[model samples]
Target: MSPPSGATTTFLLIEHRREIADLNERIRNRRLQVLSLYGTPIVVVLTLLVWAGLKIFIWLSSDTPTAINAIFFSVAVLLAVAAGAQFYAEFTATVWKDAETPVRELRLELSLADERHILEARRHTPPPTDRQASYKERLPQELVRLRIESRHYRRMHLMMQWLLFVSSAAISAVTAWYDPPQPAKGVLIGLGFTITVITAAAGYFKPRERAFNLQQTADSIEQHATALELGISPYNASEEKQNLELFATTVEGMRAEQRMREQQLDQPQQGQQQVI
Candidate 1:
């Protein structure tokens, strides 16, 4: 079989680039839409919770009018309904599905043409002479997977930290404001216990540290890949095949380290059986 002409390869590259750009745009827009859909409702609900807390304090301190209480209750109910409806709408939305259809079709076309696979292999994989195409493809994919895992764990770490702070603050506020004979005191005690547990868990897990280490490893791998591609510094002195082999070995080492870290994270605490 004849090799593809330069012009044909260039045309295919342009077409794939355009398709990827369009798909990326659509995916981004869909993400924004989903965030907005959920974010607005969450903000509203939090505001309502704060307002309810304030109202409860007011009611306990003094005799709030029946009309005022009734109105507040009605508004709360309305807000809840609105938030629930928005959540339902978001759940039922097919925006992601619709956006992915075109992307899938484009991917299928590119795959059949064999252009996409070649381009990706060339861009991401080590030199063809040093590593199997499959191994090269796997390395780039593993890099992406690690990056995603790092981000996810980072977000979770931050979220848990915030929850711990918020729960602690809630306990403090409840303790300062309400005394014995009030139900709020019991709530405060419960919150305090919960916060203690969360603090202990957070300390033991050290998710932030794990996330940071993962991120660093991923960044290192990415830097090495980029340097190899550009023929810069450490990679520049070596022949192409030697550089490719070194790159593969370096990436494999990083991947092994990442796997070890993941295993440590998965390890059970003393007396606790690890759950898959």
Candidate 2:
């Protein structure tokens, strides 16, 4: 039996690949959401808030006799919150499983296409419509992807910085108006703890640095791509293929450098840990 046409096979490959990627991304995001919901820092903050709120309520009501009951009540509320978090995590896991099923099906479908046939079809296929897609065809896609990631990191950095500022100001204000044995003290403690967490997160993650590195890499790739298109500088080659090859090489090098930067950012203390 003869193999299918090159165009049909290519279309099938591209369509199924895209769907699988999307499904995997969805599953990954759901897992991250569940993990964040029950993260240690989040749990600690919630616990502190509950304790503070309960203590304040007891003090305000002047029900000194029921202070023991308030303690038990706070315990009950924390238990209930834990149960809710467990249920949400389970629900998220179920959603992730559902998303994964489609991905498995898609992979199985692709596996049914004979590898030899797919490769042969691709070989006979004409070049893609995009002229710059001659080699390292994914460079443009990766550039756009990096730009999106850069923007996401930038937004996170901005939000975290604002959180730090607002939380610090709140703590200072509460301290200035401090009165011992008052409910405001509880509020001040909660604010102080939150600010400490935020500061630690900002220092550890360094989102601003990540955003800057990503944006710089994206910009460099874009500059090279634009130069290649316009036949300028080092990209001004007599042969278009040479220019494209150069563009692909330079873009790939930039991407590799960006990946290295990310690894360094993620594991800055790795060497210290190893030494210890």
Candidate 3:
């Protein structure tokens, strides 16, 4: 294999990879900052809604306590601060864009260089006898991604379910006893609504089902990977290439099946929207 040109060698250096990774991290941070700017006010608004609801109940009972008034004032101040932050973010959007522009342009440049570097590197490097080398390299990363996604959905489902059950139980306990005070009743009312919303979210999102599918897919892929390594049945092809091909095909088929199941889960929402 001929040595790559100086320019190609420089392009393939670790520095470019590090710079690209750094730029990506910076871009991600910037995006998160923008998201936070947008999200803060919305979160504050939701909080205000809940506080307002409680205040309304208090007002209806004609019991305007001093503590309630102070709490309301604090919420108002927090809302104002959130609004100011949002407005400042809006005003500075151009600044953010200017800062991000050069980073993006540099990343694009580095990406092109990286592509050329890969091409050059590939030209100089002998092809692997085992085609499965690349696939095996990627399989673990894919498995990790699937498992992470599974855990995320599983956690969300469990959290919502816990909230649903606890809220129901608390409401039940309260109702079963003596008649509650006005403030207690208002809190119970909020809990009841929370339960309803959580239930609806659980039903619509189907997080438990999503988690199950992702975990099952990941486990199947991992099992295939192990079987291929051990040369077990189905992956017991005499030819190494044939076994690798079988593993690749089986793993990809499982991924596709998981995707189909995800789409199936979404179909109900799509159907309802179409009908509406």
Candidate 4:
């Protein structure tokens, strides 16, 4: 029998989809920005390179020549590096767009729990049309599984990170080798190297950090959902508070497995846990 009306069940949830109407609030996949950034520098570098090559060709035919090729090499390397870095930033932002799914899944779990609580509180609503009640009952478990799946976003995140890396390495090597910056142009060459190094490092590591964070968050949320699906609500306790322990593990650290242990201790091992 249902509890006498208004006994709400709340499940923490993450929504898997983003549907915010405001464009500003929307998350963009990091890929688009990265393409632009990478592509732009490539374009700029190529133009300068071609022009420089033309100048070199012209110099060869002339009776006398100036140090035009040196200037061209100096400028081209700097521009290519700048573009690569810019693209890297954009690529990571694109990765962040994928973060929305984990957030969304968490939201969904919470929303489902809220529905469960509401249903418990209600007294005499007609049975949900057809299998709707059964469907609702199954939702909690499904939600947990869905959330667990979201944890892999980090894997995808890393893939994109590597993509940027390989591309950057190839580009940088080619730029350096194809047109070695001359020592007489030491100042310019040094500046170009410095910028390229800095940008490459940032682009490579920043998104990996974010991917880690997102995975951690997803794991925590999924664990919480699992406990709730089995009828263990941390909302009430002699269970004793642990200072948002779940959040700490999944959000800031790799504690999904630890969370599972904590939640299991909160629940029972003797009986088969209910699913659906």
Tell me how candidate 4 scores on lDDT. 0.48
* Candidate 2 lDDT tens digits, 1-276: 666686676777676566556655655665664565457446656766766676697665665447666775666677667656656555655633443234445445445444544665566666533345655455678778888988998998899889889988987787677655376877877877888887888878888888899889988987887887789999887987777767777877887888877877777577536634
Top candidate, metric lDDT = 3
Among all windows of ten consecutive residues in candidate 3, which has the lowest summed lDDT?
Answer: 94-103
Taking all chains together, each candidate's TM-score versus the true structure is: 0.48, 0.60, 0.63, 0.25
Off by over 4 Å in 3: 1-19, 30-131, 180-183, 269-276
* Cα lDDT, model 1, residue 167: 88
Model 2 has an lDDT value of 0.70
Residue-by-residue lDDT tens digits, candidate 3, 56-124: 865767766788778867877887797676566556555454243444665676687678657766665
Model 2 RMSD, rounded to 1 decimal? 9.1
Stretches of candidate 2 exceeding 4 Å from the true structure = 1-9, 15-132, 135-138, 270-276
Cα RMSD (angstroms) for every candidate in the order listed: 9.7, 9.1, 7.5, 17.3
lDDT of 4 by residue, 1-276 (tens): 755432322211121122221222332333344456557777776878687577677655764244655666667777777766664544545544433244355455546655654554353343433234334355456446534544454565566556556655655665676556464255456545655665655554444444444445555556664664454666234332232333233333434543453344344345216410
lDDT of candidate 3 vs native?
Answer: 0.77
Better of 1 and 3 by TM-score: 3
Write down the TM-score for model 4.
Answer: 0.25
- Which candidate leads in TM-score? 3
